[model samples]
Each structure stands twice: as C-alpha cells, then as structure tokens.
Target: MTSTQRPRAFRIPAADQTGAIEGDVAPPSTVRMVEEPFEIVEAADGTPVPVAPKSRAPWLSLLLVALGGLVSLGIGLSLERMISDLFAAAPWLGRVALVLLGLAAVALAAIVVRELAGIWRERRIELLRARAVEAMATRDHTGAQAVVRDLAALYAGRAALAGGTKRLDTLGDAILDVDDRLAIAEHELLSPLDRQARNAVATAAKQVSAVTALSPRAIVDVAFVVFSAVRLLRRIATIYGGRPGFLGFLRLARSAFAHLTVTGGMAVGESMLQQALGLGIAARVSAKLGEGVLNGLMTARFGLAAMAVCRPLPFIREPAPRITDVAGELLKGSGAEKPAP
Candidate 1:
C-alpha cells in the first residue's frame, strides 16, 4: 500500500445482512393495512326494499269463523222450528223443556260470574307481584315487607309455600336492609316456591303418558289428556299462588290453539314428547298413533304454558318448566323411575 493511502470510506451494514444486536437496530413494522369489511353507501331517497308479508293465518281463521257463524245460525233456526212444533204437539212437554233450557242458561251465567271474579282476583295478585318487584328494585324495605305480608296472606292455604312465607316474614322482622331482605326473599322464598311449582307441572306431565296409555279409543285418549292438562294447570297455578278455574282452562286452551295456528301448521305430532303428553287434539284429528303421541306431548307443553300464564308472580330466579324435558321423561316409559330431563 502507498505510504499516503487515502482512508477507506466507512459504510453502515444493513441489519438483515449483519444481524444487528437487539435494541440497537430498528425493527420491521408489525402493522398491516386492511380494507374496511363493509361500506355504507347512501341510497336514493324514496327508494324502498320489497319484502314478503308474514302470514298469521288470518284468512283461514276468518273463513272458519264465518263458517261457524253460519252453522250456529242454522242450528238456532232449526231448534226454533223444532221447539215450535213440539209446543203445538204437547204444550206441557214444551214448557218443561223451556224450564230446563232456562236453568241451563242460569248455570252458564253463574259460571261466567265465577270466572269474572277469579280474573279480578288474578289481576289484583299480579298487581301485587309487580309492586313487590318495583319495591325490591327501588330498595324500599317498608314497601317490600308490606308486599311480603300480602303475598303470605294470599298464600295462606299453600302448605308448600309455608316455609318461604315464614322466612320472608322473619326477614321483615330482622335487622337486614332492603337489599339483603330482597336477596334473601328471592333466594329463600321465591326460588323454592318456583321450583316446587315447576316440579308439580313436571309430575303432572309424567302422569299423562300412564293415563293416556290405558285409553281404548282416540276420543277417550283425547278426553283424558284434556282433563289431565286442566288438572295439571290448576295444580301448578295453585302451587304458584294463582287460582285457575274453568275459564282459566278455556283461556289456556285458546292460547294453545293460537300457538298451533301461528306455527304454520307444522305438525306437533312429529315430536315424540308431543305425541305422548297433551292436547292430542292434533292426534285426534290425524287419527294416527304417532300423531296421538305428539299431541300428548303438545298437551304437556300447553300445560307448562298454562302454568306460566296462570302464575300470579313472575319467577324470581328459577327457570320456567320445560315441556321437552317433561315430555321426554313420559316418552321414555319410565315415568316413576325417571325425573324430568
């Protein structure tokens, strides 16, 4: 090398090539650029999207209602003509028939009066429950205690709810504040009573299979199913501190039918549980063993639904009774040995 050689120019090495020490060199970026998943584009004013209308089976229902009205009118006319003919032939017999008809009408009116009274009671109880819930939510100890007292009085005859009522009463007398009292009431009183009511419905559903299995005719099966469902709903309602009577049963039946209609005629008969438990109305009409079983299951579902409708108070923490579980237990042919699913 020459004595006076120029100094070599220094150059920095790339990190990738030289493997620069960590924390000494800049690192590659971890960020990525991405397009937005969706874009909102403004649409022209007055433009509308077309959609199919939902059918609630209104037309079919209307048609049936009209047909029923016509039939009822025809029956009334025919009955009137027959009564006139009977009066002309035998005035004494005609008078007796009139008296019997009047008595029957009076009996029907009495039933209507009883139903109205029960409905009034149900509304009052429901209002009480709502007020109690509101009081609990607002942390009003005095109001909540008053509600508890009223509920206890309403449930005086319910032996199963005695413990819960007593516990609630004790809470009202204790040093616990509103929140504690409400929490304890829900845990110690409402929850247990709810469970007991649900268990009662389940137990009734389980018995449906046993009772229906013994029926010789489809009509008999259907009758037994309906009777069982009415009893079950009443039992469940009573357990939950509600009074379910004849009108209550009718209300529940109407709801069940409406449910069937709204489901687009989807056969409840396909479900094994529906087939074995309740409302076998579908089964009766279908005239199939499988359909009958499905109808039975439907009846159980209706019973559970009726209980919900009849309950004076909303459930605090417990879940509503499941028709599937109750019906499943019945379909398994082990009503006594198995509990609800």
Candidate 2:
C-alpha cells in the first residue's frame, strides 16, 4: 500500500474544463421566503369623505298635526251640541248619557295614560334586556342576573296593570318565568352554552314585551264598553220618557219612516226595472231559473250573516248565526257530496 500510493481517486476537472459547482447554487441575496405586512391603501386624493345624515320632512309632520287638531276640534264641538240637544229633550236620558260619557272619557283617559306608561316602561325593559344580553355576551353572569331581575320586576308590575283580558299579562308572566330560568342557569348550572341560551331568552322577552305593549286589547275593551253603555242609555230613553219625550220619539219615528219610504221606493223601482229587463231572459232560462233564484237568496242570506257577525253595517246580532246556518245549508246543496252521518 505504501508503494507509489496513487493520488486519491478524485473527480477533478479536465484540463479543458473550468471549475464550477455541480448543481445550482443560490446567491446569499436571493430570497428563499417572503412575508408581507398587511396594509390598507388610501385614496391618492388624501381627502376624508363625509357621510350624509338622515333627515325627516318636518313640514309633512306639521301638516298632519294641524289636520288632526282641526278634526278633533270639529268633533268636540259636534259632540257637545249633540249632547246638549239630547239633554234638552229628556233630562233623565240626558243624565244617563252624561254618566256614560263621563265613564267613557275616564276610560279613554286611563287607556291613554296606561299606554304612555307602558311605552315608557317597555323602553326601560328593552334597555335592561340589552344590558342583560351584553353582560351575558361578556360572560358577566352577575351583571346579567341583575339586569334580568330588574326586567322581571318591571314586567311583573306591567302584568298586574294590563289586567286579565289582555294577553299582555300572560306574556309578562312568561318573560318573568324566562328570567327565573336564566337566573338559575347563571347561578346553579354555569356554562358557556347556558349564557348563550340566556341571551336568546332575553331577546325573546324583548320582542314579546314590545308586541304586548302595543296590543289594542285595551282600546277594544274600552270601545265595547262605550258602545254597550250607549245601547243601554238608548233603551232607557225608550222606556222612560221625560216630559214630552213622547213627542221626541214621534218625531224620530216620523223621520225614520220618511227615510225608509224614500229608500224603499227607490229600491222597489230598481228591482222592478231589473225584473222587467231580465223577464225575457228569465223565460229563456226558465229551466235554471229556480237554481239562480235559490243562489241569489243564499247570497243575500250570507251577506246578512257576514254583516251581523262583522257588525260592519249596524245590524241586530241575534239573527247572525241563524242566517249563517241558512247560508251554510244553501252552500251544501243536495247535489253536493253528502257527509258521513
């Protein structure tokens, strides 16, 4: 091995070749990886843009307000005159009317006051709900519980005042129950999921409160009472006439008869004209005439029933369901499919 040890076998460049690395070699300045910072480019103009604010057309509002005021004044003057006339005719009837009017006025005033108070309370409740939601979102269970308690108290008071007829009281009680559940969830069974559920409950309560606050049940009740009182007063007036009240009744009857005569004559003339024009057609269509007549009668009966039920055209209520039943029978003719016995 010591013999002329051949130079270590090495792959050396040939005499004609120049020295160079075998593969590609990257320069130190060459980029291996690149990262960039997030940047928001601004407009070249460098001017800040302005946002337009919303505006209401105050002139329209003012016009509506003025019109409402005029209408109210006219109504008030008319009502006073009507009341004075009624009183001059019959003192007892007048007294009853006055009492009824006073009751109606008091009820109306109470309704307005209650509604305004409800609106205010509802706003506060909404604020509490919002705060509760925010507290829940932020994981402040204690703060959320406090807000919920305030909301429950506010709703409970509203529930008591809204009375039993309106479903508002029921809705309030429901919201309070929801608050109790949320409170339990926050204290006894604390969990992130429970916080979300509580927030949902608060939102639902807010929606329900808003709807109940705006319900028209109170106004409807007031209207029903006022109308009922008016009906009673009219009955009383008919029963007990003040001095010469019989004369008033006579005059009213005469006026009513006059109106009926004119209207009835007109209706009869129109009916006669229609009959005259359709007589030839009726003769031609005699085979189906009975069916057509029956259909028309049924239609009239149905119309009467609808009017009675809806009270749209001022009809006595007693005949409503009877007429409705007749209409139903007409609709269910013998040719129609029979029902199971």
Candidate 3:
C-alpha cells in the first residue's frame, strides 16, 4: 500500500519569483524586460528654411544722411537772417561770420567728394580682385595677369588723380608686388619633381602671363577701345533698341540717353555746388576785416572733419563686404545647404 502512494505533487513559484527551492524546479526565468533608449528623429518631410539676406546699408541712405547736414546749414543761415537787425549794427562781425560759414561749407563739400571717390575706388579694387580670383581658379593665367596689371594701373591713375607722389609710388610698388608673387608661384609649380606638379605649375604660369602681359600701355589701349565701343553701342542701342512705333522710338531714345544725361548733369551740378560753396564763403569773409584768422580757423576745422570722414580710419566704418555675400548667394541659388554651424 505504501509503495503505491501517488507521486508527490510539487508547488512551483510563479514566473515573477526570484528564489527557487530544490524540490521545485524554477519555472523558466522571465527575461527582465529592458527599455531601449528612445531616439529623436528629424522629420524628413519638413521644408528647408530660407536664410535671411544680409542687410546692407544703402548708399542712397548715406547720401541722404549727408543731405540732412546741408539742410541744417540752410536752417542756420535762415536763423542768422531773422536776427539780422542785431547783427546789422556790427556789419563787420556779420561779414566775418559769413566768410567763416562759406569756408566751412566749401571744406565740407570737398571732404564729402573725396570720401565718395575713395568709396568708388575701393569698390573698383574689390571688383578687380574678384575677377583675378576667378581667372586664377580657372587656370586662366593670362586673364589673371591682365587683371593684376589693370588693378596696378588703376591704382596708379587714382594716385595721380589724388595728386600724391606717394600714390604714384604705390602704383609702381603694386606692380612689383604682383610680379614677385607670380614669380614665387611660378617657381613653386615649375620646380616640382612630379609630373602632376609640373603640369599644375605650367597651368598657373600661363594664368600669370595673361595678367602680366597687360602692361600699363596695354591697359590704357584696352580702356580706350572699350570706352569707344561702349559709346558706339550706346548710340546704336538708343536708335534701335526699342519697340516699332514713333512713341516707342522716342521712349527708347529718352531711356537710352537718360543715364548719360544724368551723369553729365551730375558732374555739372557737383562743380556748380562746389563753386557756390566757395563763393558764398569768400563773400562772407570779405565783408569782415579780421585777418585771415577766421578763414584759416574755419578751413582747418573743416579739413580735419573731412579727413575724419574720408580716410579709412579704424573703427569708423566697417570694411565693405568682399566675397562672402556673393559666395553665399551662389550657394543658395544652386540649392546647396549652407555649411554646418
């Protein structure tokens, strides 16, 4: 009877239990569930955001700012007239005041002109530099050399126009500088033992030659040729580049002539403005009998002010952008993303 006893029934722990007994085999151990880290994914369907354009301070806006000063001068003159009876008693003093004002105005105008000219020259230099870089990149040595020569010539002409021997010297110095740099580059390229290096050097040399060949004499000739061509084309464009109608022809003529006329008129206007400023100052000073002290003082003050505005003084005006904006625009237009932050 004892031998026939039923097999012992054993209790097993549930799947969640940790400890196991010898009589009871542990139920298959439950795998401890682990949570994998959640990854943040960017949305593939999102539209690319457009970059904001750089805000440039408009040249016209700067011109207008200077106009404000001119307007203030007018206001000051009007005020002086309104208080004329007080000044009338001392006609000499009035005359002196007038002379000082005139000198000041002439000085101011001259300074502004000089500054504007400098800005123009700087812009031209930047343009030339860009052309040179392009020519160099394309292995157009001739073109690069031509650009360098032209730049040097331009600097020389500008210096001459500025009435400074130093600037003239700068022009010669610039030419020498370009020659030295080209020579160095040429040497590097030609001296390389590797065939690849030699080829590259040869290519660079060709580009250098292109730029260098445009000597001062050649640049002058090319400039004359271009100027003549432009004038001729402008005339032709005026006559023919229009719709087929009497009114259209007239419009076309006017439109074509507009730029030339405006430029000519501006030149005349500037000259007249300068003369008027000078006359006004002279008339005012002549009426007063103080030694040239008032005139000299005014001139000195005005000259100083003008230099402050015109010269490339540090921390006064930020340098104009050269390549960054142009490169950015090119990249954007080509549907390329900006370089990573």
lDDT, candidate 2, 1-341, per-residue tens: 47876667767667445335557454557433323212332334644344445577899889999999999999889878878888899888778878988998999888776555544543453365466556645766566446545534443433332332233324333434434435543332222222332233233323222333333565643443334323322232222111113333333334334543544422345443443333333334442332332333323332222222211112111222232232222223322433234
lDDT of each: 0.62, 0.40, 0.39
**Of 1 and 3, the candidate ranking higher by lDDT:** 1
TM-score list, all predictions: 0.49, 0.30, 0.27
C-alpha RMSD of each candidate structure in angstroms: 14.6, 24.5, 28.6
Best by TM-score: 1
Residue-level lDDT tens digits of model 1 in 159-189? 7668887777765577667555555655655
Q: Of models 1 and 2, which has the larger TM-score? A: 1
State model 2's lDDT: 0.40
Q: How far off is residue 243 in model 3, in Å?
A: 48
Which portions of model 1 miss their true places by more than 4 Å? 1-113, 136-143, 173-183, 186-196, 210-217, 248-293, 331-341
Clash number by candidate, in order: 13, 0, 15
> Per-residue lDDT tens digits of candidate 3, residues 1-341?
35877689876668656355456556556544324323332234544444456689799988998999899899988868844754677877777777877898899888776556544554454465466556645766566456645533553433322333243334443434433434432232212212222232233322222332333454653454334323323233222111123333233334334533443422245433543344344334432211122222222222222212212111112222121121222212222322223
**Candidate 3 structure lDDT:** 0.39
Best of the candidates, lDDT? 1
